[model samples]
Target: MTISESPHEEEPLVASIDVGTTSSRVILFNKLGQEVSKHQIEYSTSASKQKFASGGARRFSVDSAGGGSAGSAGSAGSGAASPSAARQAQQPIFSAEGIAIEANEFLEIEDLERPTNPTLTFPRPGWVECDPVAILAHVVQCFAANLITMDKINGDRVSRSLLPYRVRCVGIANMRETTLVWSKATGKPIVDYGIVWNDTRTTGIVTEKRNSTPQALQDSLRAKTGLPLYSTYFSCSKLRWLLDNEPAVSEAYEQGDLMFGTVDVWLLYHLTANHAFVSDVTNASRTGFMNLDTLDYDDELLKYWNISRDKINLPKIVSSSQYYGDFTVPQCIKPNLTSVAWTLLTDFCSRSPPVPIQGCLGDQSASLVGQMAFKPGAAKCTYGTGCFLLYNTGTKKLISSHGALTTFGYWFPHLENPEHSQPHFALEGSVAVAGAVVQWLRDNLRLIPKAEDIGPLASRVADSGGVVFVPAFSGLFAPYWDASARATIMGMSQHTTASHLARAAVEGVCFQARAILKAMSSDAAGEGQKDRDFLEEVVDETYEKSPLSVLAVDGGMSKSKEVMQIQADILGPCVKVRTSTTSECTALGAAIAAAMAYEKREDRVLWEDLKDVKKWIRYGGVEQGAKSQDGSAPSKSCTYKSQSLDTDRRRKWRLWEAAIDRCKGWMDIVEEGTGAASNSAVKSM
Candidate 1:
């Protein structure tokens, strides 16, 4: 891929602050994928219990002994207060020594306006959510942290080792479908709680559309939108849910006061002080509102949804790599405590032509860009909390039949040539839970001593010993959107050891990944695009012809060599695990996007060329660079090949599928147990 040189590159740095569901990260990249400097901080989500309670009890009333104005006073205290204020009220006020908690804990006047804890929570089943205002606060905090970290490590020895050492521009890549209705006037989220992708409350709306719209019409919409009618991950479903259920949102929609967007657009508007309410084509495509063919919202779609184009402010869909806006440190983040001289110096130093946020794509779309799977039929599986596989389908649309999603690959700007008008597409498949099972094993069950220990423990046993763990924790997604499903560990016996369970958990993730790939292949076959032979060829070509293919795995789980080997073994031969030792792929991907946008390199070279891959080490349990530290070639590349275990694997896979069937019928049992317990509690009360 094209790497921008110092002489040809533009001035100022681009920055990307990725605000994820679980944590927040800030990254800086030059014109090359090389990371300049980066910082990561984990933010806690509101507890599950709080969210369930909040969503259940929608009424604002929390009665007090004194009625009348007391209720009004309580309402005013909670409603008039900012999110920051609400959070501050929850924090315990301490004395100088921090020994005693104050009885009447009063928030300081200065702290009243800012929330001490601005986090998201899932208040109920089928309702994954967040506080939109809190998300903005976290964004500001992450940016400040990046700057501070870079300043502290500017001259440090560690900084020099990690980066070639220049920070120029910043670009933000975010979660695609998490959406909100915000007001342009006050710059506050119109919705108190942000609806995230996992929220299935919109099922009713999606079902209605599927039932009313003709099959041909729905197919046409799917072909044009690069999305499936069954998808609840897009904003279309969430938007429909709000419009149907929330009267306020519907009223706002009628008055033309509503602004709708993915997190990227929401962030762009807020970052630029509401001057620009736009998103790149990558984010737009996933909305289901945007037509994949036109790369704009379809008139029919808007009409069907009963959303007036004039009423809803839609962002201009731009290329993934382009200048969006400049970063003017918000006044909220400015250090008011510092002297005027220091404040002026800081402001002057930070100010630069908005570090060309040259690259902007949804996190998954960006992963495709980052993986460098530019050619059609080329695929990559990103093993993270979730497993997502994207097969590049070039410019053609391939509607999925086997649960695979059709999504936008990238949007190249129409420079001078009219031929480059439309955005490219990819066949995308997502596995909701992958490495998350490992986290559950670590945190919830304490199956392993530590998170990383899972690898070593699983290594003790070569395989899962017939134990199949279907980690349908929050229900199965992609290929099967079974919302009622929960986790199931079947084929267990007295002989099952901790190691067996651990191995099964890892294998379960691999099974899901394979399931998605199987579905995508099946869908393509059904579409008459290609059959299993073509798909096998795709995998074969990826390994034999492509530069790298041992699943370029990243994320916290990628650090586990044992896990990688298991992933390879299950997928069969010629599988190569190509990645760096560090779990820095997300940051690396962000850096790459920023580089591509700012440098404005040859679109083909930047996207399709093999030069972007600086390292493609084979997957080995041992921690060693695919290449030597001296920048020399490796002695050999590791390849995983299956040996006469097809029958066994197929048997295990069938067992896994069977386990899902059993889990499907489990809701009744769960409800019965919960019902009996609730009855007992009521009697006690």
Candidate 2:
């Protein structure tokens, strides 16, 4: 399928925002996957050692008798406030004392001036947290900044004299499993900071629950949640930690004013001006609360977690590519931009109707869509701070025995029954440290001047020179599920230089990814009759009977040729690495989802003109085989075939596996030492 130019005019553009761990990005994509304009805002993740009051500490008493314009400005109304109003009323007014409590029902001018991006804090080692209000502010700031920039670039096209270049919809892709709980009445977070996805502070909570819970019940949880109770990498344990430790969160829960959400839901609620409290299935599935088979919150899982259904307001689960709600630019961020740009954007938004937030996905799922890995057995590896390799398992939610996650790929809104759409499932292998290893080398070790320098520095070395580095900084995720595993570098000698260590770091990431691929292949092979046959066919068709045959790669880390080469070399000859031509796959994936939903819902003339456009945009479509607009066949991807000798590769892999085994139980040793200390203290007492 190809994009056919419309004789009339260009269609309204689609926009997507990717809220990542380290940075947030906004991108505008035409229907054909070409980037029009993009903007990114980078933020620090280093934890501040200070504590601040929760947003809810700021209380306001509303005067129901006074008639005010706060109603028109989207404030929660007087009297018994609506759910949305209650949330709005809870928004904190930032002040010198941290966040100030106000008596007024409406926001004062000073409240709008407070910055949204809060510094991530680490109160203790291995614990990572961030302020939810600050995160909300970052989202709003990115949108306003990007929209203002986009409008300036295309302002002429959106003139009153011409057909306006309306933004048909916005799509969101966010880091998954980062959990937050807020007040239903005031919409303020019960705690000052959200528990980030990678935070391991709740490891003890998960361990205690597993030890106390019945074996039969634990088995049932695995069946229902498609996740193990062994790791704190998910939302369940994080939420549990909050309820047990934070008085504010527990108090709100007891009062029936708590609402739980992943980052996607939090952004959606604020973006729609608090009207929508929903989460797409892709993001919801990662929370460990939603059932894989039912695609909804599981009562059994809730009971297992000791969470009451009535106490916390869970987001309504929706399809990934549906009209979630309309987004109005919040007034708070207007002051941050230049006066001219703000004026133009405000005027433009006033002239144009609010756009729908039509698409939402967890970052990994969005990358899968963006990579166009639509077919069963199709796979993509996103190399971000951590690497995520997702293998499309099609419709079936195949449980993984090899420790890989069985996750929702996406849920497309079916025309006849939009709400109850069937979801696609994927087998995911999450590496806790991929690009982060490179960052460690740069920041902690000072091996390289900058992150990009790793590639060149590592290229100076022929190989790791027998050095093997296992980056388990936040412990191992996927396949191993080892929270106690710590970073280990084995077989290092005096001859080992910075170059060798750098090379080893890159190889470590590749080795981890290869392990995940092997696990996925094993899980697929273990499937039932129908899936086994399907898997066989997929292997024959896509990989010529070889497992781990094809991989689509993207993200900042994939830009390193040394890394890609090592990845290809480590996986052996049968495996092929295909890097995405465009690095913006995550954002593009969201754009594609939004465009598809808009086409189905609106059925515009422009879409009708391109009726033959591929039902799903596959990664490298324009390059691999798809026809371009000018009727030319585009070039294929930059593919790398494995160059390592089979015997040597096997030997290296065995050594790597051995090194990983040595790293195991390292955390257990630390725990034992702590336990011994506690026992001695008790005896002394």
Residue 329 of model 2, lDDT score: 57
lDDT of 1 by residue, 1-685 (tens): 2234543242224467676654455665443444455544333333422332365221111110000111111222222444433443454222111111211111121121123332545566657776666566555544544454444455473445533233554566777788788775666777787788767777667767777898888777777776776656788878878877888788887877788888888777767633567888878888878877777888988887777788877778877766666554455433422233234324634654324455677877767666665555666677666777777766767787777788877765533333333466788878777766766775457676446677899989867788989888777777776656788898888989999999998888888876776675555544432423334334222222332244555555555667777776666554455544334445555555555553344532223222333332121212334545566655232334454276766677778778778877466477789999999999999
Please report, in order, the local distance difference test score of every candidate based on alpha carbons.
0.59, 0.70
lDDT of model 1, residue 116: 38
Name the lDDT value of residue 128 in candidate 1: 71
The per-residue C-alpha lDDT of model 1 at residue 250 equals 83
| Candidate 1, lDDT over the whole model | 0.59
Candidate 2 local lDDT, 325-347, one digit each (tens): 77765565554444554554466
**TM-score per model over all chains:** 0.76, 0.83
Identify the runs in model 1 with alpha carbons over 4 angstroms from their true place: 1-14, 30-32, 48-117, 152-166, 211-214, 332-354, 414-422, 523-550, 580-582, 598-631, 634-644, 665-685
Weakest ten-residue segment in model 1 by summed lDDT: 61-70
